[model samples]
Target: MCFSMFRSKSKNSSIIQPGKFTPSNTNINPTALNSPSSRSHSQSKSRSNEFNSKSSSISSRASLSSLKDSLPENPHIYDLSEIRSATSNFLLRPFSSSSSSTSWKCLIDKKQLIVTQRKLRRPIDNSELRRKLSLLCKSHHASLVKLHGASVSGNYLYLVYEFICGANLSDCLRNPRNPNFTVLSNWISRVQIIAGIADGLDYMHNCAGFKNGFIHNHVKSSSIVICEEPALVAKICHFGTAQLCGEVPEAISGEDDDDSSNYHVLKRVGSAVGKFVGTRGYMSPEFQTTGIPTLKSDVFAFGVVLLELLSGEEPMKVHVDSGSGAFRKVSLIETAREAVGSGTGRLRQWVDRRLRDSYPVEVADGLARVALECVLEDPGRRPDMGRVAGWISKYYLESKTWAQNIGLPDEITVSFAPR
Candidate 1:
């Protein structure tokens, strides 16, 4: 009977415990130990401490797990359909806000949609990007493009931006139908453009603590957009490839090539392979060689852009159709040399044929000189954006004076100073 009673007690204990276990030394059931009446006061106090410890540990783990979920693990791609629908089919809609990093616009339903898909495997350390974007959004200026808002959902990010409705400076230069096509943009317009660009750059350099290292890197005909005023409104875009002002090689990509023919072709032409990180002809020699991009690097690209505006020829095109020989491989600089060697008046011949009849030669010459100085081989020798802005402004003022002195028709005056 004693043995039978022992077996029944063991079965009862198993039923009560289920998955939970009590120490052999503890005569009390672990669950029962928690009840106030089941344990002595001292034991009850100890049991409470144990329960609190367990609860605290579980709470900490849950908090940590939740924190991890908030960060994006990868760049999430959305269906193009989703993007289209969210954007209300890209139909005309007003946006309450905008940002350059992503596209946001109103849809038919009047709800705003942000479209940004992260391209990189790792998410951009967004703290820096956010800080910069914030600064850009707050500042108001003519040259800088406007920023609206940012969208973040999981790994998806979108930047809403104001849509600019005008031809990029490059399109204006290359357009055969543009009446003002070849003339060096009137001295006034060029100056205004230059000054406005400087103001934007100045703010970028100093106001946001963004001085020194970051460069627009890609300055070309297509980069600058002209507004209704026919103003050379510089819309600096594409910060994706921007080099950090003070960081290591981790920030940039490296490429390798060993084509002597390509090298020879570039050398003869006074430009680089013009591939990879920057536009081929516009990149500085240093950027081509060492990846040492900086403010001076941007100045070099800007100089090339100015030259294109004046000359109306692609910087690398000078080498494109040359007759077979070392002459065929002649670099842009050499090509310019050959053209100039023809005569002092030959410089006028090199200007875009389209603008030949309309542009003032003196204005063209001045801008050309500025371009040359901007593209100097030594970064230190290149003029700062401030100086360039000032020079352009002066030229613009002088052109206005020249136009008035000649008693040009009202159309000419209005064209020079558009409302």
Candidate 2:
């Protein structure tokens, strides 16, 4: 009996040894742990995990690249030396030269660009100038020419723009070589041009995200270009000229409080002091009197341009009185008003003879009325650009419907040669 108890105790001690493997204590298989097939399965799983890790890294990199591409390109600030080098140290012949500004079409960094030089009207610090430039460069629209960048050399601010191949609206309308012919010969083309200008102006006045309303101090036929390749599209130039040149006052910059009282104060102060600069005939009466460029002034100028589009004449013309042998200034606005006030037949007669009386007379009459409202002497009485754009859009649709009913072709080939 003693021997039997000792055997049972020795067996239990063997089963319960700390390092000994037992079926109930552990699930490891000795054969599976060392077999070639099991080793192959373990290696396969390790490779799968490694591949998944690499795939995750690749996916992460692709996502980062996509995000980088989505962001807007930052505006370039060109060095003065670079501008000088591009223009051959200011020896290159200017593309367009005027008393107030000069432009040069040159290659910069292998990209074609138009560099315009204008005298700075006021002194701005580097920080403020950079801020203004950043804002200007960020704003983009199909109807507005893009401002690539700008450079400052002493009192001159050199504005760089993407070189667009097109003719100015003034030259397209009134070619000196072909006085009787105009590129905007069709009624729909004229309507399209005015509608585009109205939309661009409305955007500048109300939808540009400007804290204060943007004022285009220069709104004239010469400031617009007509692109005729794929389609007839009008692009407004000198988009940020007023702001950069300090033609806009601090009160109108939206830097101060935005309120009617402040605006009234600005008008009074602007009228009371400061010399004004603007294209003749396009300037509103208030702008002429107060020397303050305002949103209403832009509207007045747009009205004049619209009338010019209708009449196919310059904004202001000198007519010699055959009877009196005296020169009289005949305003397009006056003629438009007279034509609309008289009757439909008078308006039909007043419409650009180039159209050959193809346009809808009623639509023309309504457009003339709208233009008159815009040119009203009182700034307060004139409609805002938003309303003007709305009217033009309505007229444009009407004109399109009229064209379709008449089976007029959309495209009309015309000479695009520069005057």
Best by the lDDT measure: 2
Best by TM-score: 2
- Compared with the true structure, model 1 gives a TM-score of 0.57
Across residues 1-419, which tens digit of lDDT does each residue of candidate 1 receive?
Answer: 00000001110012453686675774756787586676687587789888998998899899889978743233222344555667765463533222322234443224333333332222344565465455445544455444444434444455443455455566555656765553234544544455455555544544434433345555666656555433234555433234321111233322226421111111112333333345668878877786545666777787777666656666675344546533343334434554545654887787666543454567666766777777888776777666676676667666666666766321221131224
Off by over 4 Å in 1: 1-85, 88-118, 125-128, 151-157, 176-195, 206-209, 230-234, 239-276, 318-344, 357-360, 409-419
lDDT of 1 at 176: 60
TM-score of each: 0.57, 0.80
Q: Global lDDT of each model?
A: 0.51, 0.79
Location of the lowest summed lDDT over 10 successive residues in candidate 2: 1-10
Candidate 1 scores a C-alpha RMSD against the true structure in Å of: 24.1
